[model samples]
Target: MSDNNEYQGRIVVITGASSGFGRGTALELAKRGASVVLAARSPEALTELAQECETAGGRAMAVPTDVSDRNAVAALTDKAVARFGRIDVWINGAGVAAVGRFDQVPLEDHEQVIRTDLLGVTYGSHHAMSHFRARGKGTLINIASALGKIPTPLYASYVASKFGVVGLGDALRQELGEEKITDIRVCTVMPMAHETEFFEHAGNYTGKKAVPIPPTYDPKTTIDELVRLVVEPEDEVITGWQGGPFSFLHRLMPKAIEKLMAGNTNAVQMGESMPAPKTSGIIHQPSKA
Candidate 1:
């Protein structure tokens, strides 16, 4: 059976298409017969993904793009539209996360994440809306995180960015409804670190590093569920139990939730310096020490 209804021949644009869930979801959508638009800053990775999609008997294209650039994003939309004549779906998967304590984290750290995670969605969805307004149908999918709802310790910037995404998606859903734009759907995909390469590149505070929780808790096993929802349709989905508690406890008991997470210095790591993500966002590379 097809994983999509009315998705055959549809054009789907995915940002951060080089690795992780972006890459995985792009290929899977191709397998489902959706024409995929693979996007990212890394040309080599996207080029390889394109070839793989083709080898799978699916039509695909690798467009090297930095979603933080409005011009680049518009070009991305233009290319997708030029290739397929219209866009059926837009997925903003490009994001960066920093794991560290609040004080140790630099203010400049999150600008990149906000650009790619929050503003990238703004650009993609804005462009998608213009296209959908003309065509009368389309969907905007932003890959948020479970922390979008519950703020996390180590990933303050990441959580803030994702929280913006969740708020953006929810608000846009309302804005589109008010405008009578019934065909456009705005949603978010919330997932933890799957088996993707993001972990290696995940930015962290110089203050500390934390132990690995469970790899199974990551994306590989749960990614299918995320892809399934984007293919089908949904409001918002909580993917795992690591995520389940926050929503439940936060709602039923906010004070208790904060108390539980209070002063949990688990994520703080003291150090000289660590690697910052280069291929992910538009932030300047940290000075080489």
Candidate 2:
């Protein structure tokens, strides 16, 4: 649990602030007196969120950005700095997933996932690290997934991207330590399938609607953990009770875990009813949602 007023006057930058965990985190932090910089592809949604933050008793700014574009991401950083002077916390919460059999999913769709989920994170970390190094104290939070450590079937590209994210966060942590930058913290968060807008925005080619696997946790489970890190920094955190057991099982019996995922692929990958047409979602274009 975090102390009351722990986030007061902190400057937090959150991507994917239009909805889901990013939106929740921004509101919760704002209520605690943190100024939040909201970034996403939807300007209208971001603006509305910023107003909501202000109503909660903290300052806020909205910068419409597509994380996949390095220039746009750079511009976003500039806007945040211009508005708040400095960023205390940077959370890479923007992500898109595609679900279908690996061979059946479009090649371009697979690449889109890599660009947004993996390279987008690279871009955020690159800019945030430069700023944090200059400031000498800051937190970089990379939102990975439980799938990063334990791969699941039918989400090949998403699994690949998240695996890369996990590796990137660890590598960055070590580099910071080697340079004796102990004041700057690099934290990675891995959560099991949770209730979020992820399924709605995800690209799909599975001929069925996308849905979170059973035992889905609430979005607050992840958001609360994110808020806690603002006060007590850590190297890595696996949110949600289910995620803890999944990580443990993966360590004890990797092969068995893989087999279990394979068996559960159908339920994890698609809904029973028919789905909308194949779409690349917001990966190739800005999200209107």
lDDT of each: 0.72, 0.88
What are the candidates' C-alpha RMSDs? Answer: 4.0, 1.5
| Model 2 regions more than 4 Å off | 267-276
Residue by residue across 1-289, what tens digits does model 2's lDDT show? Answer: 7875788899999988888889999999999999999998888899999999999998999999989899999998999999889999999999998888899888998998998889999999999999998998899999999889988877899999999999999999889878888899999999888988888788888887777766689999999999899878899899889778888888999999888877676765564645678776666776775
**Number of the top lDDT candidate:** 2
TM values, all candidates: 0.85, 0.96
Cα lDDT for residue 238, candidate 2: 91
Show the colliding residue pairs in model 1. 193-218, 194-218, 194-219, 207-269, 207-270, 208-268, 208-269, 208-270
Return the TM-score for candidate 2, rounded to 2 decimals. Answer: 0.96
Error of 2 at 241 (Å): 0.1
lDDT of 1 by residue, 1-289 (tens): 3346545787888898877788888787777777899988888888889998877657898898888899999999899888889888888888776666656666676677677778888898789888887898777888887668766566677778888889988998888878887767877777754556565565654433333323236565555764665556677777766666667878898777655554343422322234343332224431121
lDDT score, candidate 2: 0.88
Off by over 4 Å in 1: 1-6, 207-218, 262-289
The candidate 1 region of ten consecutive residues with least summed lDDT is: 280-289
